[model samples]
Target: MSFEKTWYSLNEAIEKFGLEKGLILKWIEDGLVRAEEIDGKVERVNVDDLDLKVQEMTGI
Candidate 1:
């Protein structure tokens, strides 16, 4: 079967979604999206949660 990415680094999410870093960070803080710290340094975003938010924002 094929595999799909379930998570993305903060920078990757920002680049892929064309969203500002601060906005993404705020989402994480507001619990609109989920994130996890990797190696106690990099924060990875939950792709599914982010996609849902995008859909809500765009009404698509």
Candidate 2:
């Protein structure tokens, strides 16, 4: 993975994590995943951050 890539939309993140979009959004709101609001609507999660959480949860 490249360091330059650091962002993901709600849907993209869902597919990446194999979780539902609603769950991803809930995680964001729960302060589990860092997110930024772009275009005043879209939520983008840091790809690196998402990966970190996956590793933490699964120990893989």
RMSD to native for every prediction? 2.0, 2.5
Report backbone clashes per prediction.
0, 0
lDDT of 2 by residue, 17-44 (tens): 8977776677677887889996766578
Cα shift from native, residue 22, model 2 (Å): 2.6
Off by over 4 Å in 1: 38-42
> What lDDT score goes with residue 5 in model 1?
94
Please report, in order, the local distance difference test score of every candidate based on alpha carbons. Answer: 0.87, 0.78
- Tell me the TM-score of model 1: 0.85
- Model 2 scores worst on lDDT over the 10 consecutive residues at 19-28
- Number of the top TM-score candidate: 1
Q: Write the per-residue lDDT of candidate 1 for residues 4-59, one digit (tens) a residue.
A: 99899999999889989888888888999999976865489988898998999999
